[model samples]
Target: MSPSHRYEIEGCEVIWAIKDDSIGNTFFDRGAAEFFLPHLTAGKCEENKPLKRLKYTVTESSSDSPKKGDTAMGGALGPDWKDGWRMKGKHDQAAHRVQVEYQCEVQEVLTREEFTRTGQTAECFPGTSRAEEQNDDWPVYVLLTNKRLYGCDFVVSATGVVPSTGPFLHNDQFSVAPDGGLRVDDHMHTSVPDVYAAGDVCTASWEPAPQWFQMRLWSQARQMGSYAAKCMVADRDGEDIDMDFCFELFAHVTKFFNYKIVLLGRYNAQGLGKDYELLLRCTKGLEYVKVVLQAGRMQGAVLIGDTDLEETFENLIVNGMDLSPYGEDLLDPNIDIEDYFD
Candidate 1:
């Protein structure tokens, strides 16, 4: 979670002030320090490679929804997840459903005067105008679902981001992806020669490995930035550049919910639709391992805890060897899978 996307009301005490707050994965949970700066940013950040520094334009969005000045923000920047979890689709979705949801930024903050009074408020709060009741200087929040307004003390928004493709759009100089990022080839070159882009501002236009896809995450940003620099040097020196192995497969390592987690390939079965098979082994709070297989070939695996399967599973995915004969025994806890394969 970038501090850039986190916004808070002055002296806000809503989530903790109440009980049963089931907002979208409440990343900076009730009573937790707003960052709660997201552990994702701590260890997984890109190294300070020897490259020229690029500047970014930081802007805050202040749009408003009419029903309530309140809205939960999410977009290009993506969602703020728990203390960890580097990249992912949305949360609390049904197994049959895969969703990527982006909530609009809080359109506007409501002042006591700008707030609307509705009978629902009277029935809900019983005779007290919520707007009139909140601190005069603080912004008011409303939970709006389907145009119906519910009174709320405050809301925590995990803002999304769209690539800022500045003046390049003026003359149509660079190809832009639907997500509003500059499209770059394997070398991270824009359609316009000699121009390169990296980080959240550019999109990978090449055909990615089947087990790999892109998400706007710090880890990816680091990889792309470093790779782009190398490509620049290679081009300047008239040398050939090969696509970095980092782009060959999707992988992330982090600790979330107190478990050491290692993600490999299409760990969530993303883009596989319903054509994949899933096998999961979990031991309450201690461990969770999920593997995605297609036609008996390993495509991805999510290994939580120190399950010691990362190396073997990674080899399994990259080598693309057949594991059909092992059947369920592939994950049999009683059997030593590594030795079986060795």
Candidate 2:
């Protein structure tokens, strides 16, 4: 019988199954790896390579199942684990929590079918609290789950600014198009004019010959969101807004667990950057990284394994910086290479 889900002990930021690649390692000691992400990312960033696609080869390892009587700590990984992360000197506990949860959920799903299908049963008693008969000295403990006491004078719905439905939690977004070229929007806005949306929820239209421009992405989102917010505020205040700025959305790139992943602009934008050549290089591991360029300008990057270069890569992409400065240094692993700025 096949189980609905399976669990494992591993830590990974990006799990690309199509490429048979799983960037980042999960199901490992959290404490040990907490110190590895930065150094690893930095090492890869120093390489400055890029990839349009890639694959991963996963190796499975066994983990002991919890004992019959072991108590579930809900979400906390116990005091020792929590303290270990805190002692590491990183302020971000949410990252550690997310990685741990992913592993635990994977494991729990694997074991669920067995426990539920074996005709097992859970028993609980119905309790009656008699108001008058209760002892007067006992203290009552009340746990609030759905209390809505936190009131906000102004409500900002950051749910999303794009037309697409939701977050890119498990997989990327997919949608079909009219021409039927298999439009892979990735996350571009669906419309324009009176409204503009960016980030992972829009499909932008930009044409070199047509001489028009529109794009979607995190950086674009920040700019567009600011513009939109200002527009709204301006309209409310009866002020004329510029609204002349154009959005040049680029792909989002980052490193995690050691995997380098880049999501270039709408995948369906065919012939968009087709003529622009990009260079890529990598060594095999649990994580991989890639860098992209166009006409000598560093356009974007996808990094895993090492991400220390994220800031530099992002700067170059945003500023459309000339990549010729560090072309030679990118491939050299031992060149004390921060001089690209000079």
Among these predictions, the greatest lDDT belongs to 1
The global C-alpha lDDT for each of the candidates, from Candidate 1 onward, is: 0.61, 0.35
lDDT string for model 2 (1-342, tens) is: 000010111121211111111213321122223433344213222223444433233443333875666653332121122212321212232221111112211112113334345443321111213352222221211111221111111211212133443443233333423322113222222332233344334443333222123433344555555565666566568787554334343444533333444443222223446755445444545434355556677555545445355565555656666777667467455653345553
Model 1 residue runs over 4 Å out of place are 1-109, 116-139, 146-154
The C-alpha TM-scores of every prediction are 0.64, 0.36
**What local lDDT score does residue 289 receive in model 2, on the 0 to 100 scale?**
38
Which parts of model 2 have CA positions greater than 4 angstroms off? 1-227, 240-274, 324-327
Per-residue accuracy of model 1 over 154-269 as CA lDDT, tens digit each: 55554555788886788877899988899999999999999999988999989998888887776788889899999999999999988898887888765443345678898877
TM-score: which candidate is best? 1
Relative to the true structure, candidate 1 has a C-alpha RMSD (angstroms) of 12.1
